[model samples]
Structures are given as C-alpha cells and as structure tokens.
Target: MRDTDLSVELCGIRLRTPFVLAAGVLGTTAALLERVARRGAGAVTAKSCSVRPRRGHPNPTVLPWEGGLINAVGLANPGAAAMVGILADARRRLAPLGVPLIASVFAEEAGGFGEVVRILEEAEPDLYEVNISCPNVAEELGMPFAADPVQAARATAAVRAATRRPVIVKLSPNVADICAVGRAVVDAGADALAAINTLGPGMLIDIRARTPVLANRMGGLSGPAVRPVAVRCVYELSRAVPVPIIGMGGVTTGEDAVEMIMAGATAVGVGSAFYQRGMGALEAMAAEMRAFMQEQGFGCVSEMRGLAHGA
Candidate 1:
C-alpha cells in the first residue's frame, strides 16, 4: 500500500490521492473538514448551499435500509454568503496539507444558480460542483432539474458565466436519459460531470407509529444498491461526452472505486460510504484500489479509465 501509485491529476488539479470526500460528508465545519483531509482525502466537497439559507426537512430525515440509505435532507445549509466564509476558513486550514476544497451549490432556478455562484466565487474554492439533482426538494419544482436537458443547460450556463472556477454538474439517475442531461450541461459549459446522484423518492413506513420513516415521507436511495446503475451511467457518459467524469453512488471500497474508474470515472466520490463506514472508509477504499491496480499490473488511474466502456 505504501508503494502504490494512487495519485492522479484531475482537470488540471493535482490530487495526492484519488479518493475524495463527497458533498455533505463531514464538510460542514472547517475543523471537521481539515480533519478529514488529514485523514487522507485528496479533496473534499462541501454540502450544497444556495443563495438563501434553509432549515431543511424535520427529524427522521434519513433511514438506513437493508443495503443502503434513503435521505431527504432537503439541501439544508447556510446560504452561499455564509458558506463562502466557511470555505475560506477550510481552504486556509488545509493549505499546509495542500488538499483541494470543492464547493457545491444548488438553486431552484437558473438565475438563482448564477447568484449563488457569484456569491461563492468570493470564497475561491478549488472547484465548484453544481448540484442540479436533489430529489428531496419541494414538490412544486416537479422532477430534479438535472432530469431535463433544457433546465440543466440553463442552470449550467448561468453558473459557468458567473465563475471562472471549474464547474462540475451533478446529474440524477432518476432521469429518463441521464446521458441527455449530461450532454446538455456539458454543452452549456460544464467543465466536468458527476454522474448519478441518489435514486428514487423511496419510502419506509413505521407500522407502529403509522407513518413514514422519514418526516419528508420519501427520500433519495443510495449505497451498494445504486453502484451498478452509477457504473452504467458513467460508462454511457464517457462515450457521450469528452469531459472527465467524477463517479459516485455506492463507492464503499477500493474495488468499488476501481470498478468506477474502469467504467470511465477519472475520480471517485464516496458519500453514502461515509454513513456506512465513517471516514475510515476513505482510507480503506484507497487501499483496496491500490491493491487491485497493482494486482492488475496498472501503474496509474488514467490507464484504467474507460477500460470497461464497451464491455
């Protein structure tokens, strides 16, 4: 493990290692984020912030099922203005370690996306992950914005115009055509893409209380169950667009990260795994990835990207 070459340079940013802390996973506080970075994340993504603050949904917002978790966090966070300060503090704290900070932002409309992007631009994160697909939001917006090509493009374009930072559009697996949305956003100006946000507005009922497990009634499903679907989406996106893909869904182990890379992801995002195994999962995944690559006679992650595209 000590001699494994697990490092990668993604979209011009050099990552000491390939494992990144996905959004909403220990990204709230600057101290916690620095700790995760010190624990061995190549980079960290902050939770989705918007132009306005949100209290999000009530208690019982997350449920751990047999193989995964369903959550309706509803993008709870301080507004973009407040988050910028946090991002600055994190960047300053992690500077000595040279870890990159990624800021993720979301909004209900294209204009709001632009506004949030502008507000966050002041924080100067290493990159920006434009989240257009949160299944836990209000019903009035209908499906996730990433589900529609027109909406995806509009939002992506707004953010692109607002910031010079590399923008990665996060897509939803619940869409009818994930590739279509990917193409739309990339065409609009996304520098990269993160495939397969959670799946399903799934539910779990509490028979005793005669109510749903989540206060929101339904939530997006994630974990091992969605890894296969994520692989398929990343594989398709690799062929559909020329941008580097950040693959996520159920990456809990190094083997899972390997599978994602072989499926065409330049980098792997581990979110649900945090809930399943805590921060230790990041190191475990990296170790597993190194072992698999070494055993397979591969020297670097670039060599394995898209290796499973046609297979």
Candidate 2:
C-alpha cells in the first residue's frame, strides 16, 4: 500500500488524503474534531454555523431509514462568535496533526451568509464552505438556496466578494438540474463544489402516534441510500463545471470513497457512517483505500479520478 499515494488538493489546500469529516455528525466539538484529525481525515468541516446560537428543533430530530438517516438538526450551532472560540481551541489542539479545517457556515439569506464568511475570514481556516442546502430552517420559506441556480449563484458571488479565502459551495440534492446550479456557482466564483448535502426534505412517521417522527416533521436524508444519487450528481457536475468536486452521501468504506473519486469527486466526505462507527473509521477507511489502490496498480488517488468518464 505504500506504493499508493492518497494525497489530493482541494481549493489550493493540500490534503494528506481525500477523506474528509463531513460537516455534521461528530464534528461539533473540539475534542471530536481533534479526534477526527488524529484518525487521519485529510480535512474537517465543522458543523454548520449560524449568526447566533440555536437550540435546534428539539428532540426526535433524527430517524433511521433502511440504508440512510433522516435528520432535521436545524443547523444547530454555538453561533459564529462562539464558534470562533471553539475553532481556535480545535486549531491549537490539531496543530500537530497539520490537518486542514474548513469552516462551514449557513445563513437565512445571501447577506447573512456573507457576514458569517467575513467574520470567520479572520480565523484563517484552510477554507470556508458556504452551506446553501440546509433544509430544516423556516427562513428558507419554502425554497432551498441550492434549489435554484440563480439564487445559488448570487449566494456564491456574495460570499466570494466578502472573503479572499477559498470558498466551496455545498449543493443540495433536492434540485432538478444539479449540474446547472453547480455551473452557476462556479461562474459566480466558487473555487470548488461539495456535491450532495444530504438528500430530500425527507421524513419519518411514527406508527404508534400517527405523527411525523421528527419534531421538525421533515429532515435531510443521508447514508447508503443516497450514494447512487450523490455519485450521479458528482458525475454530472464534474462534467458541467471546471471546478473540483467533493462528493459525499452514505460513504461507509474506502471503496465508497474511491467510487466517488472515479465518479469525478476530487475528495469525499464521511457522514452518517461515522455515527455508526467511530472516528477511528477514518483511518481504517484510508488504509483500505491505500490497499485497493495498490491492488489496482494505481500510483496516486488523483489518477483514479474521473476514470469513469470518457476522458
């Protein structure tokens, strides 16, 4: 496996490998963030941040599906100011690991998103990911940011204008033509794209109560069930845009990671599966990927990228 090189670059940031800890899940605390870095994640994206702290939607926010998970965590966070403190501490702890940290911020509007980016720009994260696909908030008012290419472009442009740091636009799977939206963001100045921020404004129903399983009644669906769709999105967007892609959705193993890379994702994010396993899973998955690459006679992970495409 030493013959296989997993190094990859995203938005000018060099990663030891292509595995990244997805924005949600065990990414909320400094301790967890450090653990993920030590476990071998090339980079880490914090749980989505808002302008102020939120208690979230209250309990029953997540439900298990056959192959994925449904969650309406409501972008719950300690807010940007407090999040800066949290990130500072995490950075100090992770300094020795040399892992890149990508701050993930969400807002109700384009201006709000830009404000968060400008504020966090001082913290000097390796990159910033503008979360335009959060589905649990009411401010969305029936429309998701990533649902429309025009709106997505505006948001990307606003954030890009606000900061000099590399910006990654995380897209939603709830759109009709994801590639079109991706292209718009790229044209608007997105340095890269993280395709598929969960699938669906999905829901779970409780048979006994004859009611929705979540307090919010609707949540984003993730896990193995959305892998195919996520892969397809990566494939389509990679072909439509010139920017790099970070593909994620129900990736549980190294093979899953390689599949996304072949589908045109320059990197992959591990979400729900981390909840089922543990942070150590990141290292294990990387090891497995190295083994697979060696077996396939591939010298570098980037060489396998977009192999499924005609190029």
Tell me the alpha-carbon RMSD of every candidate.
1.6, 1.4
Across 138-229, the per-residue lDDT of candidate 1 in tens digits comes to: 57456778878999999999999998889999999987888899999999999999987888878899899998989889999899988999
TM-score per candidate, chains pooled? 0.96, 0.96
What is candidate 2's TM-score against the reference? 0.96
User: In order, what lDDT does every prediction score?
Assistant: 0.87, 0.87
Show pairs that collide, candidate 1: none
lDDT of 2 by residue, 175-269 (tens): 88998899899999999999889788877888999999899998888999999999999999999999999999988899999999999999998
Tell me model 2's lDDT, rounded to 2 decimals: 0.87
Show where candidate 1 strays beyond 4 Å: 1-3
